[model samples]
Target: MFSGAQISLYPMADDFVSVIMAALTGLDPWREALRIETDDISTLLVGPPEVLFAAMRDLFVRAAQTGVHCVLSAAVSRGCPGEPDDPICMAQGGFARDLALPDRIAAARANVGLAAVTGQDVAAQFSLYPLGEGPHMDEIYGCIDFLKASGTFDRSKNFCTRLRGDAGPVFATLCEAFTNFGTVAGHVVLDVTVSANSPSAR
Candidate 1:
């Protein structure tokens, strides 16, 4: 299986460059575990789900901690048919593919419950796509059920769901939503945008 994310970070400040560069240090701990490549447009992180989401959380939190409004946009995907299998992408202790939908939902919730608290408040909205054949809506609705009970769920929007809470649980929730639904070897994608310190919130 191959898993990765294309992410872009925006800092609402004049010194955006400095903020982004400094915040990149947050990925240091995860570097050995992930393949990180940066370009002018976005950064690509290829790795296991556990390390992937944590890296994103750390990077975003570091930027937000600069007291600047920061937004993180990510296109996360796993098991893309077009991508070759990568040994480094192997994950440990994830829900089995044959698990019932309800069972997966429960496991996802339990995973989110153990997330580390980062104490950084953030708002996020995301859409999960379980591509390919199978009971897609059932999977989505199951994800919704998990989200409603996630303690971070804010509301349901037109094409996405919103969540608000400390960065830890919020990111954890996103991670579970990404990993739990859909066939384990099927293509799955998640579109996410997370914001902190936005002037609109103040």
Candidate 2:
């Protein structure tokens, strides 16, 4: 046996384990070789490594197609064949409370002023909204709201923000989110620089 298993899932109020579970329910029809279970803090899925990895990959792809943003934290547990662990049932509300945090996304909005300075051609110092408003304000607000509650963010102010990510994943996510809200790709203008030494330095 591989002796190792991995899990990739997002953190929701209820953790939406079902959405992930639905993607993986078909992974093992036998459902006897291994055990799958969840608690309030984490979802414990155990099985063949190959099967689990493939299943998680598929889950992420499906989540993207569905336009549901998620922060994926992985869990790698080594199981001993001598004994079967009791179904995971210990944690917050029966699940892991180690919720995902706010992710910084790279974004830009039409800056008519910057366009004028650059003659709408070569790029220049631009002023733009990092988290521009989308057509579906309510939906975005709902997502932000949920993030505030489940993601352990302060709900006093607008959750939408301006910041950067360690990698381009955050930017990619924002672009996808905007596109889903009917943003015209041509209008977005961003000039974020990524460097290994200092991501927030000049």
Candidate 3:
């Protein structure tokens, strides 16, 4: 399977460059585990779900810690038919496609409950797309049920779901949403945006 994310970070401050550069150091721990490439537009991180989400969380938290409003936009995907399989994308444990919907929801919830607390409050909105066929709506509804019980769930919007809470569970919830709803070996994508320290919240 090939899993990766194209992410862009935006910091609302005059010294955005400094904030971005400092926040990037958070990826150092995950560099060895992921194939990382950065350019003017966005950074591409190719790796397993665990390392991928954690690295993103750390980076975003670091930026938010500076008390500057920060937003992280990510297009996360796994098992894309067009992408070749990569060894770095191998994950240790994951739900099987054959698992029942209820089982998957339970597992996803349990995983989110285990997420560490980062103490950084954030709000996020995202849409999960389980590509290909086979009960797509069912999978989407099941994911929605999980989100409602995820503790971080804020509300349901027109085209996406909103989540708000500490960065840890919020990001963990995003990871589970990306990994659990779709077919294990099928194409799945998540369009996510996370924000912290936004003036609008005040």
Worst 10 residues of 1 by lDDT: 90-99
Model 1 C-alpha lDDT per residue in residues 55-139, reported as the tens digit of each score: 9999999999998999999999999989999988888655545789888888888888999999899999999999998789998
The residue pairs that clash in candidate 1, if any, are none
Give the higher-TM-score candidate: 2 or 3.
3
Q: Please identify model 1 stretches exceeding 4 Å from their true place.
A: none
Per-candidate TM-scores read: 0.98, 0.31, 0.98
lDDT of 2: 0.32
lDDT of 3 by residue, 1-202 (tens): 9999999999999999999999999999999999999998999999998889999999999999999999999999998889999999998656545688899899889989999999899999999999997678999999999999998999999999999999999999999888888877778999999999999999
lDDT by residue (1-202, candidate 2, tens digit) is 2222334455232546565656454445425544556566645555543334333334444433333444444443323334354443111111111222122111122111111111111101111222334444443543344323321222233323333321223323222222222222212222221112222232
Report the error of model 3 at residue 91, Å. Answer: 0.8
Pairs that collide in candidate 3 are none
Off by over 4 Å in 3: none
